[model samples]
Target: MLNFSNNKLNNEGRLRTVLDIGCGVASFGAYLLSSDIIAMSLAPNDVHQNQIQFALERGIPAYVGVLGTKRLPYPSRSFELAHCSRCRIDWLQRDGILLLELDRLLRPGGYFAYSSPEAYAQDEEDLRIWKQMSDLVGRMCWRIAAKRNQTVIWQKPLTNDCYMEREPGVQPPLCRSDDDPDAVWGVSMQACITLYSDYDQGVKGSGLTSWPARLTSPPPRLADFGYSNEMFQKDTELWRRRVESYWDLLSPKIESDTLRNLMDMKANLGSFGAALRRKDVWVMNVVPEDGPNTLKVIYDRGLIGTVHNWCESFSTYPRTYDLLHAWTVFSDIEKKGCSGEDLLLEIDRILRPRGFVIIRDKQAVIDFVKRYLVALHWETVATADSSIESDHDGDDIVLIIQKKLWLTSGSLKDTE
Candidate 1:
């Protein structure tokens, strides 16, 4: 637990951001944010490396790479200061070149520092390594300004060299999971309800919390009564036709009619078949609702006592089918089979080992997470993905599950 108390540098910018050089289990970055950027350099030692869940929880961006790698990822003159925290001597020595990159990433007149606990320097070598860093910083126009028991602050002299031609921040682009099977797309199926429920959230990404005042009262959504899935099938084709009609509105400009025809077909499909993404935006947001009022007479009759959750809050349902578009509907049906054996198979395809998934039970569509999705696995945040319009009616079931993991490379012990 390192503490940051630099008033002089923190005072310069209206908002302050820092890069935690070797931030181990230490998320002080999320706790402190004056304004901008806070990321962890890509180091495998950090168990949570590439863990967007943690970063998203705190609104911080995560990235990969060792310091001083050829070009810095950020444009020159970006940060007011560069920070390194809880990194000791062994790691510091190997990352010596990284400090130069940090200095290079800093704004014209920025500061760099490293912090640790009171017992930060365990041995004489740790003190010697700090001296080595101090010397290097001095040669590069950085001068020591302040020092506490285990923290040292250094300032890089104001220079145009830092402003002229630095590359962008070494941050990776947003995770586009459709292309990568291993990486998560950050969207969920159950999460899509609230999105489409509204006329605007699907197209514009406005949250239900911000819906117009007049439309505050909730209404019948897709999952109120129970699971039929037939409705999803019908809506799929409807969305496809609508998208195809939309594409026809645009003039033809392609070289090949065959490709054009394919594009036309995909356009109707919606998610994968989506064309002109500008018109429709794919979305993901926190929490969801599977509405109960939208039920038909048959299943709605059985939904008497189960619609609500343990919390007993009628308004806190997790109802809403995100995207009712064709491609999403088809995929949901194709991939996620009904519970039991099919459920396990679908779960296998959708989740990685140790990866968790949120499932919506077809039986009782409750608004609160406590209703059903929790029994499967969703103890943490629920997950879903789709291209259909989402609704926030609070009727969707949240199924949380983690993929199973197994040990590999078992070996005999060396007892000799």
Candidate 2:
């Protein structure tokens, strides 16, 4: 067994709290206590409560529950590290029921270690499990941090559904899957239910613990539930044209005097930037660092795009642009664990006074931006709804917003 004391994989040596499932007699918890680490162990002692008392006597906190049925009695994102040793239940299963609960329990960038002696077995049954496990990790949105002989470790993503591929040629990651060949949307009903159920239980974006209290409806199903490479390829041209036509329609209405510099958030293939080139606007685009390989084609077209991981804070100065164009950017960001409020705040910081924002996105995102705009006192100049919707996606709504320059005492004195 790898030493947990100084393992670099334990969140860069800052491992604090651990959840040890199927903790037989809580021996691991006792050891963790010796190392001054908080060990929250889970075990069953209904027939005989001796093991529970033993763990408590050792100064280790332990809980009683059937792992698969009962929800873990803890807040969301409560553990930094989770471990399971032959926990009876198949941890590598892609069913998404219990695993979704585990995902919710783990903090962003937290670690999960599952140890199985079967992984080292040469038997046919063990071999099949190992292969399925491999396939499961490949389909999951999480990343595999490391693997020992019988133990595999995973890290929870900072943002769910956001791809972070090291190589450019690989396909973008999928959020959820059912392994079903004939299901509509190619995803099983169970998988969709699990994903949304977890989301409702507070498996949400970075810095968020629960869903908005104002939301009365149940959480929606995973928006990109059954995404595939073929689907993306087919829709690429249609999406590109949608963006181009959106800007073409808005070009005449925009105030030419104020539209100088432009920033395109989530600039997939840089189509929106290319669309703005007809005007004299200096366009800069932002894309995820591990975005699709098609981005190379955009670069080949001589468009300006900067690679950025939107999961983290953006690197830019305030009030840097006069115009911002976003097509489905807010929805994508929201799906990947970024709140629209947070993104709009960043947009507000980087936009100049009286600058314009052109957003072509879904109704939810538009509502979020409008709420914040009203709170921030920004002005909305126009709104439009597209008659044509995405082939399989939601309808698009457009909003034109202008940044307001308010007169403060300091700035008023400067003008005087």
TM-scores for candidates 1 onward, in order:
0.35, 0.40
lDDT of 1: 0.34
Residue 380 of model 2 has an lDDT of 83
Candidate 1 regions exceeding 4 Å error are 1-9, 12-15, 34-52, 67-72, 88-95, 116-122, 160-416
**Candidate 2 weakest ten by summed lDDT:** 210-219
Error of 1 at 332 (Å): 28
How many collisions between residues are there in candidate 2? 0
Alpha carbon lDDT of each predicted model = 0.34, 0.58
What's model 1's TM-score?
0.35
**Maximum-lDDT candidate:** 2
> Given candidate 1, what's the lDDT at residue 205?
17
* Candidate 2 segments whose C-alpha is farther than 4 A from its true place: 1-253, 388-393, 413-416
